[model samples]
Target: MNAAEVVKSLLVQRFGIPSAHLNAETPLRSLRLDSLALEELRVLLEEQLDIDLEEVSLTPRNTVGQLVAAVDGVAA
Candidate 1:
């Protein structure tokens, strides 16, 4: 899967969000993800995408596009 698909799948799996609402610009804060969930997402990304995000912190305000960008940036 592509980065966008990876991001969407992660959000859906981690937050139990339906695919219909998993837009590229959706704000993570709207889902009310707790700190633990965020950490879980970080681990998920590392394990699935092989991208280590532990050093680069992300926040709720970060959009799916931004997250994908960060991943692409790190991979590059």
Candidate 2:
């Protein structure tokens, strides 16, 4: 799957978010993800995408598309 699809799947499968609420422009905080959950997501993304997100500057305000782009940026 592409980065966006991977992110969406993670949100649905790991965070119990409804697929209908997910979109590239959606802010991650809309899913009610706490800091711990966000950290877990970071780890999962790092593992799944083989990219280190420690320096990616991710935040609750970040959109799904931004997250995907960050992963894509590191992967590239």
The candidate that wins on lDDT is 2
TM-score of each candidate structure, all chains considered together = 0.83, 0.90
lDDT, candidate 2, equals 0.87
lDDT of 2 by residue, 1-76 (tens): 8888888899999989999998888898887876788899999999998888899887889887888889888888
Q: Could you give me the TM-score of model 1 versus the true structure?
A: 0.83
lDDT of each: 0.78, 0.87
> Per-residue lDDT for 12-73 in model 1, tens only?
87679888876668777776766677788878888888877877778888776787888777
- Report clash pairs, candidate 2: none
